[model samples]
Target: MTKHFTMGGTATFDFIELLGGYIVAMTGDFDGGAFARVVGEPRVQGNKTYLDMEHTFIRKDGSTIQTRDQSVLTAVEGEARLLGATTYNVVKTTGAFEGLTGQFRSWGSVDPATGQGVLRFWGSIGEASAKAA
Candidate 1:
């Protein structure tokens, strides 16, 4: 079995138009001395836009983990906000996280007006695993 931590914090993403469509990039810091870079596609519907993002979390020493996230963007209280969820799998690692393999789920939202957001993730790591429901 693996230990589970209730994890989340703040993040930000920026979007730009590409020849094919649009790609959104992200950067954020989690609670555990980790920061991440995310890349994804942004699709606009009638009233909402959604993003499917892939994230790589890197610690200061260079250890990393990856996650895939899907989120929707909309106007909330006069500010652009994002709400989404992600299914994460440890794709690579180093240091204390070497040999780490497992999965987890994360859901969160961001307020563009403030360039900040809140996120929450849960799952098991080390010798265990899980599937999102």
Candidate 2:
């Protein structure tokens, strides 16, 4: 059996928009290092918006882990917040993170006027071979 590991951290980034999506760069203890880029595509509904985001976690050693996240953005007290789920796949890992797969959940909110936000994510990670046959 593979060992289970939990990871999470806090980060801040600017909510930069581009081409129907947003490109965010984050710092401050993201998993192991910083999340270099987060590309988000949004689909809006009446009062809620759905976001498809790609998160790149770059470790201090330059290794990386890539995750696909799905989130719902809703208004809370007139501010925007996101709650979502994530998937970590072996195919998306680089260097030291290879052969690992897992799932995670994330939540955060942004300040529209300043275009800055704080984000957090936490979840368990395990080796791909741990899956049952």
- All candidates: TM-score: 0.53, 0.69
Each candidate structure's count of clashing pairs = 0, 0
Tens-digit lDDT string for candidate 1 (13-131):
43332423222232333333333334555688865677665556665556566655565565445546756566766666566566667676767776655445555666655734566
Highest-TM-score candidate: 2
| Candidate 2 lDDT, 32-105, residue by residue in tens | 54333335556888666776666677777777777776666665554454433344332377766666677766
lDDT for model 2: 0.59
Task: Give the CA lDDT, 0 to 100, for residue 34 in model 2.
Answer: 39
- Tell me the TM-score of model 1: 0.53
Report, for every candidate in turn, its global Cα lDDT versus the true structure. Answer: 0.54, 0.59
Residue pair clashes in candidate 1? none
Query: Cα miss at 100, model 1 (Å)?
Result: 2.2
